[model samples]
Target: MQPEQLMLFEIAPDFRDHKKYRDGIFKTKAQLKEELRQLGRDRIYHVLSFGGGTQSAHLLEQHLQGLIHYDYIIFSDTGAEPQFIHEQVTWWQHRQRACGNTTPFLITHHSSMERGLEEMLMRYIHTDYQRFQMPVYCSTLDPVTGEIKAAGMMPRQCTVDFKIIPVKQAARRAVMELNGLEYRQQMPENIGFIIDIGFSYDEIRRINTSQSPQFKYMRLAYPLAEENLSTADSIRFLEDNGFPTRRSRCYLCPFNCDGARDIGMDWDEIIEAEPLSFLKACWFDTELRRVQRSGSKIMRSIPYLHYSRRPLVEVFAAEYARISAAYRVELAEWVSSWEAAIQEKWNQDELLIRA
Candidate 1:
């Protein structure tokens, strides 16, 4: 019998490590199934999915066959991510179509992320950052002293305004408009939505902290958390099967791997070489924010000179220069190293199935 409650399941193994909890790998699949069965699939009115890797795709497939027909899959593109991810996503779409499933892509302009930051920056500049300021808020504190550090917050409206806000609006729109084929039925006042998040055991902090009143009362399911697999294993399994080696990489993201030792080393070099090409050209330069996050030299805000009238492109010398002026030396190094690490992970050889 089709379970009564609407079931929302996040289809990905734990992202911390490749291993699954409950003592072994691949245990996530079984664990997730049992959890969904008990979670009362009737109330599960909607399924929310974010593609992170091949395993995430697999998770959606599993649910499609057993759980319920998908209402919609909101594919949020940030204009920054591995080139191969686009292809893999296309294949996923095709395969779904072959099986008679309708998946819609929620495309957006590059300004989605950029504009939000610009707005945030404007707000900070207007308020002189006082209203938005926090003590040791953005500064890397001495774990013990918790000193009044130097590094301050830069605009990071990407996650909230750009990604999260747009996603929620799109999902709501999908349910009401009936514009897409995924909405097979009329919209319900309480169109039950269960946002399936692929958070592993280690990412529990992010998962728990992801709560918000805007999305309150709605279902936020965690099938992967129930399964307990780490992110590392998921990537390995996906690669071994001709799926791909890369994760759900975002393009021009400073967080991507860019080191020579990581999995997809070559792509990292290409991206890093043309630093001017970063999506967030503002953050591309020295790694001030990264360093500030860690304990190190702080990124200072002059408050006066830092105020800008010209476009970001012409305002700063480079991504690093802006960061250096904003933050201190240690923070800069951390940011630099971190970007490198992220870029190295997804390489050219990383297979992307785009059928």
Candidate 2:
């Protein structure tokens, strides 16, 4: 049954993670069947927000044949993920199609100019030194004594613009395609859709129903949280089902992996596999530092992607040198034809998909 969107707000109060409470709040199978029995099967369209990452993958697997069947699996590419992630998503799409799944897997994304995080940071925002602030670790001194103190990131706007907005737009088009309606037309209130996210029990802090897009035809659902699942549980499920269990994320993101080893290992692998992308990340770090340098008074150190605040290139200088030596030809290609390469390899087709 299509649960009332407002019911989520009431039953699952802010920060309510109790299993018994959640179980009681959510409808049972029989109850769901009864509630949805009167509606046509196609009345409610389901979407899995496939971020090409671990949690979203878990959600995709979980709702494969559930009562709330997904009509579309949507991926919003920021055009900055490692080549491996793109390949994995392509493989998944083809595999699902080959298996004859009726559900369509669709990829949506920002245009090249607005795609990569680094490009956006370089182009749009500037670091304000006088207003320079750190959310976490800043060395601050007494204001009267001219002391210093310690803060957080660039902007989460990248996610909103690249991922959230694009996904919503794609989902709307997918639903329109299914119904033979114009993409820009308003969705009928009677036609419900659920945007299933991959947030898990371990990352409850990241969960917020209010942050979801508000649409009369759409609502957000967190299956992982409802089922009390964690990343480890998702990994086990994928392994048991014989699906790929790789940690899916943007290669250059410092927040990509969880632990220190995994984080270091991810960077190490990227340094070996995609040197140009690594260099670009370093360029991004350097750009931030440049902004820091502009404000001589507040500039003690440069902000960086890594926790160490060292430029990416410096951290893996040896790896960079090795790759430079091994792939001299490719390194040249990176300088002379890199933009063209991205155009050829990562250029996206029109995102709208119809059944």
Candidate 3:
């Protein structure tokens, strides 16, 4: 049964209240600086975890203008971002060259799933892979009443798995290479790292910790938050400099807002700019529920890409129909190519046991 679609405005007040609570728990810039200083490493490498978005671009521009310094600038591709975001990354790379900034700009992806989120989703749909990473909205069915009610959202682990961790690993490997050490060698105790994220002041709630769980010698920092800059401020700064200001997120990110919400992260923009990716999102939205209902996966609650806990296709029926038809062949080829890749990568036969 399809769950009822709730409007964004109906939920905005609750989100606002939650944000108010979260905003208070974050550590201030002074605290972060003091923590880094306490690490007391002989050398600290500063890295920018560039997201190819407005906030990070603002920081990158600062670096280009000699306002800041970074040992590395890294972008981790989730393999699901729209082409426009990729173009924006390239645009910034060109800008970097034009400014004669010779910082090592690197691109990396999830260590296991090199294709990142799309590969993960495809494996979930096609195989018995159960490590679901997306923060999909979920609903549960009331068996007695035959009604579906909203359950809480799944954990948003993809950001760590596909984005943050990849950047960390790449930065670690890059540093290792620079020091003439093998990838698997233990890091020298004298060296430490501080990777900067692009969370703005208004997005402080998103800042959970400054410590890196995977690497003891590394710490996470937020330059934008330290400067008390909001996302809007970054966008304004980019506009003032005639730079691209598109929000960088996966094409099927659950956080995408509708046009009515007027947030910069809108699905309408995706539909217009990258119709094929939009169709792929709709495909994932429908296939996820179908696979879940098939009883092959452990996730009991029905998952949704749309915020209303409804199918994305239904939410944008007209657009989906039009775009799906327009890109039918391309979509089919995409599906076929992914299926082939999944079979090659994940469907290996088990070794036979000898008696």
Candidate 4:
């Protein structure tokens, strides 16, 4: 074979082997570990943005103070998570202590800076008079045509407005305190910081395209992806460490499709676990549906959540109904109460507007 032909033949097989490049352009674990060792760990301050979810717990159990030393671990609460999640967070705190780490856990919230998800939902429905548009990417089933369709939402600023900004602020504060510097001075120019996010190997696309911290002094790092670890690996690590896994998220977060069933938290399970919180979710859904109906120039055959284009309550109720008769009855009661509560809130809002 010609030299060019031989080179082409050697390269052609790799194109079909998708697994070889599954992690994109990042270095392997060994390469990353060596690079870290070379960087002289003393100079780098690590700040873990702990999500308090399964993936985050896995990351913490595997990395924080165990394999990697971090200066701080921060959790941003939007003031919308269920009590069960908070309990798990408390457990996580104790677990971290037991693991022989004195790194302080910082709990921050957007409520301190701006309105949280609950207030945002209330204003979106009662005051702002804006439509709840569906995310353009996700396809939803059309009741009339019995086909899946896609649309767009206004914009998903919640992550940036609520989670990212608050967490970054908290991180900055933590770093400042650690260095014993006053807030008036600019952050230490010589020091480099790593914002350790917990994206796993399965989410390689995110690892590749995700933006670094906008701040010049900070850089984003995903150790899980660098190590080529997936959710299964995370779960195994948690099990091996004897720590229970729990998903931490806002109760009404629209991103939670199928009611967060991926983390074993379907809508039925949520309602059964926290009936009051479930009612709040239903009420929130009702308001978003109202906004959609009022603002959409086009009529939608199906309803959706504040974020989703699909009907939230209807879809969740359908899933719950399939499980048990008693569950269905409870679901009906919750829906009725949610609707009534929404109506009362709407009336009160209207009265305030007229006044």
Candidate 5:
């Protein structure tokens, strides 16, 4: 294999032979039906956690076509998505209006960090905040020998922190408002919720559980998985209808592959669509390791956003130089603005503590 073709973190040779990876634990359609029966579908609130991406778009289209039902459609913005993803989201909202879909389409973000993942990264870079949420690739360095060995990637907690949990919180608050109760009030036991996720049949292994850990009355269901649909199926459906098919993801997501992978989520796509965001991603990639190496945080393993375990700027050296030259002023302005915003937030918190 060529150098670029090599994956930094490859699965073990015997990975598929392991019981955890080989054994399937997904629920059958009949089991899903029984679970819904127990929750009483007539009384339960149905929510589509619309990701503004291919798979979720398929589910949303079904809702628009009256094939499925949803009381609420929620999109959680991570604040680091490329502008094209946001445009696709707006395009869907316009489609919803065209279809006369009355179901409420709502946008939400993390409760504390309203700006979402970008806020988290900026805070980590500029402050003493230590909770790192991204699933960055990690490596361990031998101090004396100066040799580096690939450590495992960090846990992917950002999805739960900035996306899934925010959607749940927003849905909970919306239901509370509908019931004419305070947001902090406990939800009524009889009013259950079934939140539909968009994981496809091919991604069945991603399914961990049917129950929400935070809310007893809330259960997660995968409609696409239940229908045995693959991601390609959803993409084809969108293409046949002349809909937007760009995959949605954070600008700096480690899952993004090089163009050779042909997996749709590519770094080249980000570079082409939004140069500034690409530069921001490079900045985060470089700064994360710099911070980790500073010996201040609890995490000891060195972190890298790029899957190749190299600096993003180094991976795309020529493109980085070109984009940096082109967007230097704009990038500076963005950094300045975010720095001011974060400082203001910290000052407000300090005042509150004093009070």
Candidate 6:
């Protein structure tokens, strides 16, 4: 890589050992740990623990032990994360305190500059629901075959601007503020900050590509990918460990897919509930909204952004009894395995504790 590219971008291999980089798509626990261990022991760097714990994949309950050595973690809460996430955060707070640290897992990013997902959609896209077409059934025509697969409502945009963009800004501010590092400015050269992200190896391409002068002063470390526990394995690990794994989803996210077996709505409900939301939020031009009245649905039922780890299953059931029962036996078996792992960690890592 040339110096110019290093300043502007840094490209790395997309695949290792002839396999696509393992991101959320696939990975294992033991590999995930090794990734963290290799992340380094630098104190100047900061490891950001992403908040949205969609099935205990968030940094707190999932990767706390792997994160302590770094500096700070800036978590931007959209106030839309799943309910069980709140519980894991509470437990993580206590664990951090016991280990002589004070950072709360919940870094609620509140601001006078608050923007609701709905309101942002209207401001950016400049459209009203009454003016645009809504999908009550299936697609008018299929891409390959002219057949209607399913049907429902269209989606809106309350995620990108309200959550993704804002969080990135907050992360920038957190780096600049640095608790008190700005005033001191006393850190040594070549030992400046590193920003540790939760993205796994599968996401390495994005992490590598998502560079800017702003986020590049700090070197990056990916503990999860380094360890090899990509997204699928992380969920599998949580399920195998005994802790409740599903039903942990955001309250109003636009990216829900696969009719989450445990929590929240599928693409159908999301699109119907907030039509033309993304058309507006995507913001093609400041002067017009008519051209942007696009739909977020795939066929007639699914939201385009709603990707699923498993097959379609009703996500939000006012009554969750049936869904809860589906995973009862499986969840119990998983909990037993985690309990055993936790025990083994305590028994075997005593010397590491002192270090």
Error of 2 at 350 (Å): 27
**Candidate 4 to truth, TM:** 0.68
Question: lDDT of all the models against the reference?
Answer: 0.45, 0.60, 0.86, 0.61, 0.84, 0.40
Instruction: Please give, for residues 41-138, the per-residue lDDT of candidate 4 as tens digits.
Output: 33556777787777778767656547776778888877677777888788889987886778889999774435366655554554533433222223
lDDT of 6 by residue, 1-355 (tens): 5797455433442233213333332233333334434544233444454554432244444445654454454555554444445665555566567766655343634352242332222222322222222211122346688664434345332333344344445554555465445623543333334444566554554344222233333444455665654566566666675544443334334344433342233444323433232122122111121223244212223222223211122232322334335545654564355334434433353221112
Superposed model 4: Cα runs more than 4 Å off = 1-43, 63-65, 111-115, 129-149, 152-157, 180-184, 208-213, 255-263, 296-303, 306-310, 316-355
Compose the digit string of candidate 3's lDDT tens values, residues 1-355.
Answer: 1233245433332322334335644444445556656766657888999999999999999999999899999999999988999999999999999999999999999998999899999888888888899999999999899999999899999988999999999999999999999989999877888888998877867777777899988888887766667889899999998999899999999999986776799999899999999999999999999888887788999999988998989999999999999999999999999988888888785211110
Error of 5 at 120 (Å): 0.5
Task: Please report the candidate that would top TM-score against the real structure.
Answer: 3
Query: Per-residue lDDT tens digits of candidate 1, residues 186-292?
Result: 44433345556566554544453323346542445556555565566566656665655456644433233324435442323433543433323344322223333
Judged by lDDT, which candidate is best? Answer: 3
TM-score: model 6 vs. ground truth: 0.47
Better of 4 and 5 by TM-score: 5
Candidate 3: clashing pairs of residues: none
Number of colliding residue pairs in each model: 43, 15, 0, 3, 0, 27
Residues 9-111 of candidate 5 have per-residue lDDT tens digits of 1222232332333553445434554675676543678899988899999999999999999999999999988899899999999999999988999999999
Worst 10 residues of 2 by lDDT: 127-136
Pairwise TM-score winner, candidates 3 and 5: 3
Cα-based RMSD of the predictions, in order? 14.5, 9.5, 6.6, 7.6, 6.0, 17.6
